[model samples]
Target: MIIPFWSRLRLAPRIVLVIIGALLAMKAVDKAMPLVIRPPEAMFFDRDWLLATLQDIRDRSITAPAAERPALLRDLPVRQWLDITLLSSPPDFRHSEREGGFTDLHRRITDRLGLTPQDVLLKADEPDDPEYSPRPLVIILPPLPTVIMDVFDDRSANMLSSDLRIAFRIGPQEDWLVVTPKSDGQEIVRMTRNVALPLLAVVLIGLLSVWVARGIVKPLDDLAEAAEKLGRDREPRLVGSFNAPELQAIGNSFNAMQLRLKRFVDDRLQMIAAISHDLRTPLTRLRLFAEYLPDPDQRRQVMSDIAEMEAMMSATLTFASTQLKDEPRSPSDLAAMLISLCDTAADAGCMVAYEGPDHARLVYRPVAMRRAFANLIDNGCKFGSHVWVRLRETPDAFVITVSDDGPGIPPDQFENAFRPFVRLESSRNRDTGGTGLGLTIAQDIILTHDGDIMLSAAPDTNGLVVTVTLPRQG
Candidate 1:
């Protein structure tokens, strides 16, 4: 059955549990390894050599001359794998004691060699470096897998047991003999357990962290991308089945917000369209009535007033339609479209010129984008004698600029110009016949395509420069 463990866990608790589980698993492996693996007994010392050497020493103590006993013991063949040292006095025995496995080993060696208890001494310890120090008769492997083991010194490695040493005498006054194994295989086993395994566990933990982080970060990245699409008027909904409960809740909320926001925008646009459409019928009747008025001046004045009102209403309806329309985007040649606009304006007796490449492909709503650029070009021609439409390409975006040498807007009024029905009277006068919806409509269209539009003063003249930057869609 599916348990859905990750779905129920929050992010913080999940990360903590992952780390703790890894540590516990390493600990279990560390404890179980010693029972499963052990160094070869022959690697320490040959059992046959040990038994023969002890028997030779026992025979030498009785039959050998007292003066030649040291020389005979020194020539023993066991020196190849074991160190046999002869000291003028007995070695330090203040801390040496026979216990556990060492006590049994001492008793067996004494019985085999026919030696008294006072003639032999044995002590076993857990050694840090068995090659350099005396190790226990029965080896105890390193325990615990932790990062702290990396800094272990000799003292720390030997902390588990006491000092291990064995000494013997042929007679009460004879020089003492000390035996130590010379093989380093036991040290290799200890280092492999104490140092190598922990390092391996560290690498495993790092990989585990990367795996966990990717699992958590993927859903967040999807959420961020969805938010970006929503801002660009692309309705996007997030999935509810994120790995964690907290992220799933956020996804559900984001999906709900997208639905509500789309409904709100659609309702407001519909209301505006209905109001604009209803007002036009009454204005049409008024226009018909004004034509039959007795006074000519009053009649002309009434007709002009009615005409301006009709123009305003028409602009309002267009604005509403532009917002409510959901146009499908496709790849189109933006440069060709700009050139056509320039040609049309030139044919109408406006000094218009187009500059840039012959073809530039971009993904956008064709009709909406054409209307946006058309407004910019027309506004430039209306205010200035000459208008320049230039398109440029960058690595990541396409930039279009429309500049006119007319009276430019003041820096402070730049933001206010984009507001609906806002006409900067100082720069753009009433004679221009603009309802002030051109820039506003153009901004909405460009923004809906995930593009930017900004207004600035012309560099070399008193004119307005409109710059539009659109991101490259992949």
Candidate 2:
């Protein structure tokens, strides 16, 4: 049954059906409410008329002879809506002055009848009669359920148990009146229709809205996550299948784009590697020829040139071969790694100090990350006397800062320093014996790992500070 019900309707039709069904159910309840519930007697009869009638009956009963008083009260020719009755002396009624008492109704009736509050007596419950049946009085009104108690208050009708009977004063004859009004079932029906059902409907609609919204939004969120992963890695896993047609189409497009990009990058890297490899043979032959030169001074100059060429070629080949994404990521102690690097530099007589947590674990390509940090540390050791390394962890990323107390590069030359084969003549000269590809290679590796490398002047002194920021694992 559930399968057929769901199979028949698409998304749009299902939404429409839910809305129409709710409206129709509310309308049906509104129509049937009147038939199921009846209005109170107070609604049909005016208060003034009811009060005057009660007063007239009481006055006539007071003046009538003691023997005729009972008949006079019973046959008062009152409205069909009202039931009049009289009770004998020692009516055995129990009086309760508490909640659900007709205090407000009694006051209004007394004022309307031109009587003070003290003149009227109001009591709840029934007379405490010994001979009275143990069974409670029950009133029946077809279609609508009837309540034996007063509609406006909790007072039960005494007339339901006995016919007209009255108590009379011996010398100055007088009589007191008692009245009971039925409750209007319409109020309950109105509350259920206007308030209760609508509130329930609102809650149900909200739940349905959330369910539908998640169905549409979850796929888009997954697609966005896949795109981010692709940016960080060359061989990113492709997004899987989706239920929605539009989302499935988007996923297929993203997979195709990733495949094409990977192929293009692979071809370029292969071509560069082949070219660099072929050039090495000629470079070796050139070095052999330079060694055989007759003039010693000329031969030294040729050797120096050949060595520079060879250094450039080696740096280029190294940069091309070490693809950052190719390295697999694994859990490692990042703080320990930084400390070890600093220790190695210190052993080599470079004044380097490490300061940070003793053990900070993270998933990363250790070899590539080590190489990147090594380049930065090497540059600092060559240009400055002292190097300080600091590692700090943030909520979403890890930061490693390497600051050196060397002659800092000019602010304008910062961008140029990261370009391959570019060096700052003022601070970093050819005499430093660098291929000028260190920062460039480091930046490339950091970018491939979805991290960033930033260079700035040391805050305390004149030197360069390199800060690397890498995303933290979840």
User: Model 2, residue 181: what's the lDDT?
Assistant: 42
Which residue pairs show collisions in model 1? none
Candidate 1 lDDT by residue in tens digits, 42-143: 232333345566666557644777677678767877656556666668777643453444455566667877778777777656545433332333232224
Give the backbone clash total of model 1. Answer: 0
Best by TM-score: 1
lDDT of 2 at 437: 89
lDDT of 2 by residue, 59-132 (tens): 77667887896676666667244545554432344333434224444565566556655555554343243122
State the local distance difference test value for candidate 2: 0.68
